[model samples]
Target: MTKPSLQILAVTLCFALPAGAASLSDPFATEAVTPPRPSPQAAGRSAGVPCAREIPAAPLTAIDAVDLTLCNNPQTREIWAAARYQAAQVGVAQAAWLPNLDGRLGSSRLWSEQRNYNSTSAALTLSWLVFDSGARSASGESARQLLAAAVATQDATVQSLFLSALQSFYTAQAARAAVASTTEAERAAREGFSAAESRYEVGIATPADRLLAQTALSQATLNRIRVEGEARNALGALASVMGFRAGQPIELAAPPAGQPDAAFAQDVAALIAEAEARRPDLKAAEAQVRAAEAGVDLARAQGRPTITVSAAPTWAEVDRVSANGGVVGVTVNLPLFTGFDTTYRVRAAEAQVDLRAAQRDSLRNQVALDVWRAYQSLTTATQSLRTTLDLVASAEQSERVALGRYKAGVGNVLDLLTAQSALAAARLQRIQAALDWYVFRATLAQAVGALDYSLLEPAAQGRP
Candidate 1:
């Protein structure tokens, strides 16, 4: 109720309320937005944005599969949370530039032989660091660089998941194609069996020929069954990767049907250079090096001098007598000695810088090698596509001719069965080659840090 008490109460209500409100409101809270991409080209690929999303009941395309996996998979969420945590650290670093305030209140009672009295006191203190030899700046820079690293790491993780979804989708498609090939082989074998039975009934084919045709039909049927099972297993694996139960059913649209683009034959050296420049993992490593450099600066600054300003106001009411006072001062601190702790800290921070630099260089080399390997794989897959196309065509023709010859009684059943088997094998090879082409194309894009929805366009090589 006194003047000093009123003043202390006013300051407490004024400054303390805002600080309390800030604590409750969370000024550093991040929005539930999509993780930032390393490049603008990836913006169109709307994956990894956590929201209420449902997988389409209809068949999924390659792009759909990737989007679902990124949105639903835990890997993306974990990396995103890490980046957000780093963002909060940036806020913490920025806070070092601001002033701090504290308030204290105390009450005590005394009882003696001849006197009894109650005492009450209140005080408010404010401190602001005016200079710290650039320590705050160095700390803020380190935190910001770490945040950059975290963001780039998130982009790298998203690209990895994108490639994984593509690989699984393509594998499932290949398995389905294999099943179709086996079914066709089974049909061809059945036709051959029918022809053999007809020939044996008319005394034009031996019992051995009839027996061989029946055996070939049964083998084809068995292969068809096995391929169907494989296709189912492949679908289950894909479902699991998409954050669904392993047994969940997922229908996939017919894959793109064309061979990979010839433009992928670009110079390998140029591609490697592009990857080093654009790869998110490389960027992340480079950021870590810069952060380590900032850490060295922070360590050195910690051993320097600091200048701070402080203010305190006090109020007291004891034995019905009130008093008020205020104090303001500036202080300087010089770290003259710390048992050689600063010396070791500076050395450790400098060593960390060296370690980060070496790691960054190592990662840069790995990026180049990754691009080279992916390029070579895609090239090999492309060449195999041509051979597989020719192989399937020739095998189909041979099987037809052999079947015609056997039906006309000019060839043994052995020739017909062998040709049919060759055609079946050729079909499987073609399917596998197509799958490899799709996978390698995506792999090359991922290696170059450009995996996105554009790669899955209808006109791109993703079809088939």
Candidate 2:
């Protein structure tokens, strides 16, 4: 081949190869590439909190547990990632407003009989849709609304995780209190059994009385065992919610004194109103409705005419002769028919709008129900707290009297056992009431979108 022909072929070959191809090889050759694994440091960073080698020495409060859960839980990170993805979608929507530029390169070698011909061309094209009947604007608006909804949903997820951690903390505390109460009962039973054996040895009590006292002691021991198991289970649950491994040892501090009456002073009506205005899930639903409405506009615009401007500058080499040219045009495209595809799309978009509207209304009703239920629960727990305290006081006095009577040969073993059991039950009831009060208080705050770390803090009691 002549020098000019050779130079033309070399230039064409340079542009013809794929951008990332290796030198002196076909551009489209297949090669398997292994995906890279994350380094140890990167993996650790993404794995959240590291597992503890030893038990936590300090007592954890509800606030501390919530903070740990937010920092270490995978669910919280998943929500954050989703929000970031929506942000990227917003950027993509914005890019639709700008023009697009694309580059193209081509080469071909043809042979017929005994002669060879070569051609190569390169072009730079710019295309801008100058008018689209507001389709791009509607799409951008829809994406922005969806992004807002994603952010609201992420906030709701955080609130949910914190509530779970708080409830688990309260449950663990209640279980521990039950174990203590049961231990006290067991001690009381052991003393009663010893008294019954002494009385029988002196011929003052029958063998049956000793047997009854032994049975009571056995029952108390069994109850203590059961309660201790429950306490361990509760601790495991707390650890799981706090983003720790199962069976990890964790000590919990006593819950702060809470003011149930003061917290419940706000009426259900006001709470419902607050929930409607502040609840993140409800806000997300409203945003979804707006997004669906924008989608309807976009679907309608899709069937209309679009006006676009296009231009291209071209260079070509044929038979070693270089040539250049340019082309410009304005085009209008109208969809005449698409087998009813556009018609169905618009209908689908309209139905989605209706669906979103229904969802928003449904969420509003649910928020109101949540507030009402939480308010009622708080009131019932508050009342039970007072009643349980009275019951405990009475049960304690009764146990003391029965034990003294038995010691003086006036009361039977059955009376002492009954009194002891009642005292234990009363104490457990008091613990349960307190736990319920705290749980309902937190639930009400969550319903009103006011649940935060502050709710777990120590506050002045409205009643002692």
Candidate 3:
């Protein structure tokens, strides 16, 4: 009857809020979230330093190499994009807290006996989940925690690529050093052969001496050739990691001409604690555990009662006659039974929380072990550097004395060659020790989550 219709119209008009009442800000926007930080070198260039995408004309330094790798590497872009995806999920969860408004329109024509009529209707409905236990809050919290995990994962990936860049750069430098050492050995061998030839021509040296010196020269030449190839291979590897073609030329700046310092000497227990606190991967695992916990709350809330308020206003026209009416209602939904879906969901969410906690604990132990191994390796490398320096010095003196005695006809060619061989081996060991020390230092810094621009500073003055 008209009375009931009029009552419905009155309630609709009372609840039909103005569209202008809605919040102005977009609920789905993610601009508030911060992205991962770019490389410090590239950021520094914004102040005054010139930055170019192309390879620099000058030789590349370790810092420059890391910057290029971070800027051009596909992994960096992939990780940050994933973080942005998680950020979007956060926005989606946030949007759930706001009300929803829907509009509908319909037109229909009816024919009966000898009569036809058309009716058109339009309606606007507004629904607000005034209460849903704590489902909305729990979902939002879970989304935020997952976003934090994503950002932390991004940081961990960046650190990994940084360490890889350092490793490749150091390897290239070591290879070049090997080439230089071999070249010097070849020159020494040639000088010895010339000395032996001169002595033999003057009837002061045996034929065997001349032949031995020639054989030594050949071996030195072969070593130089082999190391030259290795140097090129190392450079190619460095270039590849920097997002360049493998065969591309990449000249590296000379390595620091000094022994590594003991600046890394610290208590292992303290270092492990620092790593546990600072490591981004570990932080990410913690966030995952928190997010899983939030999921459990959300699942439990889903099974509880939900209260929603809805209002709809309608306008209709039939046979040139108009009518205005609407209905306003509140819906309370309580899941009495759903084939035990909610029960299983809550159980699954709880299990997920436990799983994540276990994973986090496992990663914590691995982090401690990583710090310990890196610390020990660095310590061993440092000691080796000092010992190799002394070995090279003694071998050099022995070679000089043997060569001098042989040239003066007071020593045999065998002694001279032996001393020179020892010097060559010692030089190689010295190069290896330096490479190990630098690499292990970077590894330790990575394990501690402290690898950054400060570690890329030029070498200090000291013996290598």
What is the C-alpha lDDT profile of model 2 across 1-464, one tens digit per residue? 23443354455446544566534332322221111121112222233444443446799877667766766677866776777667667656756765666779999997889888899998777677889999999998998898789878877877788779878989999999999999999999999999899899999999999999999999999999999999999999888877778798798987665434544455678788988999999999999999999999999899999999876777899878888876789999989988898899999999999999999999999999998998898888888998997899999999999999999999899999999999999999999998898788888888888776556444523211
Q: Model 2, stretches more than 4 Å misplaced?
A: 1-56, 257-263, 460-464
TM-score of each model, in listed order: 0.88, 0.85, 0.88
RMSD vs true structure, all candidates: 4.1, 8.7, 4.5
Candidate 2: lDDT of 264?
Answer: 46
Query: By TM-score, how accurate is candidate 2?
Result: 0.85
The whole-model lDDT of each prediction reads 0.83, 0.79, 0.84
Model 3 misplaced regions, further than 4 Å: 1-29, 41-51, 108-113, 196-211, 458-464
Model 1 segments more than 4 A misplaced: 1-42, 46-52, 194-215, 257-260, 459-464
Give one digit per residue, the lDDT tens place, for model 3 in 96-141: 7666777789899988999999988877777878899999999999
**Candidate 1 per-residue lDDT over residues 81-178, each given as its tens digit:** 89878887877776777677888999999889999999999887877788999999999899888988998998888888888899999999999999
Point out the higher-scoring one by lDDT: 1 or 3. Answer: 3
Candidate 3, poorest ten consecutive residues by summed lDDT = 42-51
